[model samples]
Target: MELIFLGTGAGIPSPERNVTAVALALNEERGTFWLFDCGEATQHQIMRSPLKLSRLEYIFITHLHGDHIYGLPGLLSSRSYHGGTTPLTIFGPAGLARFIETSLQVSGSHLDYELRIEELQEGVIFEDEQFTISCARLEHRIDSYGYRIVEHDLPGRLDRDRLIADGILPGPIYQQIKLSKEPIAYEGRLLDPKRYVGPDIPGRKLAILGDTRPAPNALQLAQTVDVLVHEATFAEAEAELARRYYHTTTRQAAEIAAQAGAGELILTHFSSRYNREDLAWLIQEASRYHKPVYAAYDGYQHPIPRK
Candidate 1:
């Protein structure tokens, strides 16, 4: 899995960075990508990147803030225009459904596929065979949330050498032996997967937080995650201003990542006041609290490695 930052600015667009938008590409695992916080001109950003609107399967809105959701309607409309026939699901806080419905109605825009809007609650909102997603409320000006995505543990690889030693040459039956829940009878003997398969591979965990001050739920959502994506809207010197505006500072975000034991820390949603030269300072500030800290910019991509 990989994370692509479409925009990384805070409240408004700047010359160096745009508003908040992130794409989680799961091409290897699911053959589709999920979007988080589609800010203004998000579609334009996607057009510039390798992401495809037709392959966008899900959207998770952090809050109803204009900077977080202004590009949602335009992107949705353009998906239809581009002939996106696959169903799409959007998860967000309350009032999101109303906003999207009204936007489509007012613009007389129609979708070419099924669109499902789910108003999020502070708990597990989605669970399939491969993943389980949960959300927790965050401390922001308006109701906001942080999401935790946990991929299911993968089955272990087959013990090819052991199978070969047992006269089972490489063939389609090797797959059957590995995938069978019960023992399979072969050559008057039972072939148990437990005896042939290696230990199960651990899955990866990821946390993506919305705009907020340092909140306990943020720690809960990010606990021991492989990657923790959090907003560092201000520098460490602006701690007071950050607290007043319910935004996190670089040091604060890194501290949270350290406390949560995240493998890596990715900081985004930078204030417009900071230019390209200031980003190095922000990274240095965050690195004091957590090692492997990264300051995200427009079009930045971070690939999450398997445990």
Candidate 2:
């Protein structure tokens, strides 16, 4: 899994950044992409990247804020125009379902594929064979939410060497070993997969959230995540103003990352007040408490995800 920051600025688009939208590219894992926050002109950002909008399996909106969801109607409409047949599911705070339907209706937009929208509460919202998603309320001016995505554990790899030593060749039996419920008789002996298989690999977890102030609930959603994409709208120097605006400072986000034990941190939704040269300092400020703190810009891609 990787995080591709499409629009990382806060509130408005700038030459240095777009708005708040992130692409969780799990193409290698599930042959698809997941997005967080479809900010204004977010579809424009995707056009500049290798992302295929038709492959978007899910979209999670942080809140009803314009910068967080204004691009939904356009993106969804574009998906249909591009001949996308895959059904898309959108999860967001209360009223998101109405927002999309209303916007499409007002514009007379028609879609070819299924467009599903769900306004979420503070609990589990989505799950499938690959991942389970949950949300918790965040401390924002509006009813914002933090999302947690947990990937399901995969089966252990079969031990080809053990099977080869027992006069058995690798073939469909290896497949059976990976999916076996009990020991199977291979050749003349009963082969116990538990004895020869490698340890089961646990699925990686990712947490992504939008604009919000420092909250313990955010930490709960982000606990032990491989990646924590958070809204760091201000520098540490503007903590008071950040609180007033219901946003987080770089230091506050770092504290949240540390408390949650996140392996890596990607800070987005930066205020336009800071320049490109100042982003290094902003990241350094967050790196004080957490290593590998990244100050995201539009088109920036992070390939590593912690488990």
Candidate 3:
């Protein structure tokens, strides 16, 4: 899985960055990508990146803030001109359905694909065989939410080399050995599948949070996750301003990641006030509290490897 940052600036767009939009590319795992918070000009950003609008399967909106959702109607409309025929589902806080419906209605825009809008509640919103997505309320000015995505554990690989060494040549029996829960008769002998399989591979966990101040739920959502994507809207020197604005500072984001035991922390949603040159200082402040912390810029890509 990989995270592609289409836009990373906070509130408004700047020459160096756009607004907040992130694409979670799962082409290898699921054959499609999920979007988090489509901000203003997000489609424009996607056009510049390697992502395709036709492959967008899910969209999770953190809040109804204009910077977080202004591009939704336009992107949805444009997807029709592309090859987006598959059904699309959008999960977000209350009032999202009205916004999208009103925008499409007023603009006389129509989509060729099925569009499903689900107003989010603070719990597990989606669950299938492969993954489970849960949300928790965040401490933002609006009813913002943070999402926790947990990929289901995968079955262990068959020890093909060991089987070959044991003179069990590759055949239909190998498939039978891997699928059998109990011992299967293999060449007049019972063989246990567990003995030929490796340990179960652990699933990857990711927590992508919306703009907010430090909250307990944030730590719970991000606990022991492979990656924690949080917002650092201000520098540590502007801690008071951050609190007043219901946003987090660089140091505060790192502290949360460290406290949550996250493997890595990626900070985004930077204020336009800080230009490209000031990012190094922000990373320095965050690194004092946590190792392997990154401040994401527009078009930045971070890969999450399987454990």
TM-scores, in order shown? 0.96, 0.96, 0.96
Which residue runs does candidate 3 get wrong by more than 4 Å? 165-167, 179-189
**Which 10-residue window in model 1 sums to the lowest lDDT?**
172-181
- For model 1, the stretches where C-alpha displacement exceeds 4 angstroms are 180-184
TM-score: model 2 vs. ground truth: 0.96
TM-score ranking from best candidate downward: 1, 3, 2
True-structure lDDT of candidate 2: 0.88
lDDT of model 1 at position 108? 92
For all candidates, the clash counts are 0, 0, 0
- Estimate the overall C-alpha local distance difference test score of candidate 3: 0.95
Task: Residues 1-307, candidate 1: write the lDDT tens digits.
Answer: 9999999999999999989999999999999999999999999999998898999999999999999999998999999887789999999999999999999999999899999999998999999988999999999999999999999988788999999998888988888877777898888888898889877788999999999999999999999999999999999999999999999999999999999999899999999999988889999999999989998999999998786
lDDT of 3 by residue, 1-307 (tens): 9999999999999999999999999989989999999998999999999889999999999999999999999999999998999999999999999999999999999999999999998999999988999999999999999999999987789999999998799999888887677898878888888989877789999999998999999999999999999999999999999999999999999999999999899999999999988988899999999989998999999999997
Candidates' lDDT values, in order? 0.94, 0.88, 0.95
How far off is residue 160 in model 1, in Å?
1.6
Candidate 1 clashing pairs? none
Model 1 TM: 0.96
